[model samples]
Structures are given as structure tokens and as C-alpha cells.
Target chain A: LAKTTQPISMDSYEGQEVNITCSHNNIATNDYITWYQQFPSQGPRFIIQGYKTKVTNEVASLFIPADRKSSTLSLPRVSLSDTAVYYCLVGAFHSGGYQKVTFGIGTKLQVIP
Target chain B: SAVISQKPSRDICQRGTSLTIQCQVDSQVTMMFWYRQQPGQSLTLIATANQGSEATYESGFVIDKFPISRPNLTFSTLTVSNMSPEDSSIYLCSATGLAGQETQYFGPGTRLLVL
Candidate 1:
């Protein structure tokens, strides 16, 4: 699995767009970048994923750079409820299958009212 | 997305006691994983529960301390044995990772507080 790094915390206000960037410098060719959001006392939820370029969903959008060394999760029109820990995951496919995946200490986003 | 449910949402147990958490998925999934999250920490994979075989544990986790059972495709259980203060954390179950899609869905986690 590729190790990921992001800010420990970030602050924003309602009605603003927020972008959290994740760095995976040692990413492999077959790696896919995935993001998960975790709220207090709840499990992590899938946000978005991308192999390269860009991908968008109703909730968020993922932008992967050309080098695939980093990615960013963009949340449009943030709200106080959007405050949570966001995890960047690099999914590696090995032997034509899956491998042990781990989650790192994610970036904590605090949206103020 | 798969709908997942977990039994005993939260519990407070004494040391040396054990707590079992049950995870049920609405759809049959080939890969079920158990994870532990220490307070203010990230998740660590405890094991991968296979439907008809022994669960594959991750490094630093064992079948003795955290026993897992996967009897069918939709249900599984994780038991925290001989609990201590360090065992007080959230236990979560996830599925649908390796079945085909790259996404994984998680149950609402079981919060355990060992006293």
C-alpha cells in the first residue's frame, strides 16, 4: 500500500468550497486513490475515488494529477455538518487481486457555522 | 452500496470480560474485514473473515485476542477476549472491497469501553 500524507487539520466556513490534498509520492502504477469521511462516533464513509485525471459524484470530486503522486478531494459549498476526518487511501492491486489495505491518520476538517 | 448493521452499538465492560460484535450485510459479500480504531487514531485492520475458512489476521493482531467468525456470506462476528483498558475502542466491520468494485462499505461500528 502507498503511504499517504495530508494536513492534520483544516478550517473553513459554511458556503465555501473546501479542498483537501493528499500526497502519495511513492504510488504504484496500479494504485487507485480513494477517499473516506469519518464523523464522530461513526464509521468512515466513502466519498470519492479516481484512477487518474478527475471524477465527480453528487457529494464530492476527486482530482488526480498527471504524475499520480498526489490527489485532492474537493467539497462544494461546505456546511458545518461537513466537519469530519477525511482519509486518503491508495488501493493497490497485486497478483491480479487485492492486498492488505490500511488507513492513516486522516485530515480533520472543521467547518464553522 | 450494501446496507450494513452491527449489534450492541456501544458497551462498557470490566476487565477480563469479553464482548462480541456482530456485523450483518444486506447483500452477500465475499470479503469481510474487521478494524479497530483507537481513540483519536486511525483504523487498523484486525483480520479478513472468509466465509468457509479461518479468518486471515493482520500483523500485530491474533486469533486469540480477537477471534473472528464468518459462517456465511452476509454475517460475521468479532470477539474481544480478556478485555483490558487498552481494548476500549471502536470496532468496525467492512465489506464489498475485493468482490469487484473498489469501494468498501462499513457498518456503524461498535464502541467498546473497558473499565
Candidate 2:
């Protein structure tokens, strides 16, 4: 099992750029690093997914190093709504086997006004 | 992205009773998953509901307790049988539409508070 470690909690202010990093040292070759944001009383929403380098979407940007040992999710100019638990998961998308996507203890980002 | 919906958005049930939560997807999906999340905790995979076969349960979960039904590609249900206070949690349903694109969209979870 590829285990992931991330900060337990973080604090930020509104309009601040918050970056949450996750370390998955034993990630597999076919695995992709994905992030999800979950708010209170709601299911998690997919934030971003990346294989290497950087992938930017309208919501956030995912940065994966060449070694792939870790990944970062950058939320630009976050607001109060961005206050949620962020999960980092590593999984094989098309490995032809059952991909048991494991989510780590997410980083709880509390964005203040 | 896929739109998903779950029925009985929330319910407070009595002990020893059972609650069946329905998950419906907007389109056909190859894989449907059921997860449980205790308040202030991360999500735990309860089982994987296959379209035509018995659902595959994860560790610490069983068919007799968390019975799941996947009748087709677009719908699945997870029943919490013989419920207890410990079973009170948020039950979320998710589905992956494509094979290689492993984006799993989630429904607005069904919150069950077993008293």
C-alpha cells in the first residue's frame, strides 16, 4: 500500500494563496496523484489530478515533481468557501486490476476572513 | 463530470433497524463505490458494487451488515442492516464513468444518525 502523509491542519486568510503538500514516497509507476476538497456536511469534490510537472485547471493547479515522491495542490486566492479538508490520493487509473484508491488523513484548511 | 444523486438525504433511525440508501447516476458507470465517513474523519471504503455480481466489501465490512446492490450501470444501493449508534455516519456514493479516466464523482451524501 502506498501511504501518504500530509499536514493535519492549516490556517489561512481570505484572498491568500494556500498550498497543501502531500508526500507519497512509495507511489507506483502507474499511479496518479489526485486531490479532493470536502466541506462540512457534503461529499468530497475532485480538485485536481496530475501525473508529472504541472496541470492547471480553472479551480486549482497540481504540481508533481519529476521524482513523483510528492505533490502539491495550489489554491490561488482562496476564500471562506475554500475552507475544507483536502485529501491526497494515489491510484492506478488503468492498471487492469482493482484500483483501491486510498485517501490519506487530509489537511484541514481553515480560511478566515 | 458526472452528476449523482442520493435518496433520503438524511434520516434518524432507531437501533437494530435497517436503512437503505439509494444512489443514482446521470449516466452509466463501470464502477460504483460506497464509502462511510464518521464525523470529523476521513472516508473509508465500505464496498465496491459491481453491476451484475455480488459487491466486494473491504476489510472490517461484511455483506450481512453493509449489503450493497448494483442492479445496473447507473444505480446502486447500500443498506445498513441491524444498525447501531456506531453505524451513524455519512454514507457517500461515488461512481467512475470511464475506465482510464479515473475521476469518481460523488453524490450529496446520505447522513444517518442512528439513535
lDDT of 2 at B70: 94
lDDT of 2 by residue, B13-98 (tens): 99999999999998888899999999999999999998899999999999999999999989999999999999999999998854
| C-alpha DockQ of every model | 0.58, 0.56
Candidate 2: residue A21 lDDT (0-100): 91
lDDT of each: 0.90, 0.91
Off by over 4 Å in 1: A94-100, B97-100
Model 2 CAPRI quality: medium
Give, for candidate 2 chain A, the lowest lDDT window spanning 10 residues: A93-102
Relative to the real complex, the DockQ score for model 1 comes to 0.58
Give model 2's share of reference contacts.
Answer: 0.48
Error of 2 at B83 (Å): 0.8
Model 1 per-residue lDDT at A80 = 94
Chain A, candidate 1, TM-score of 0.93
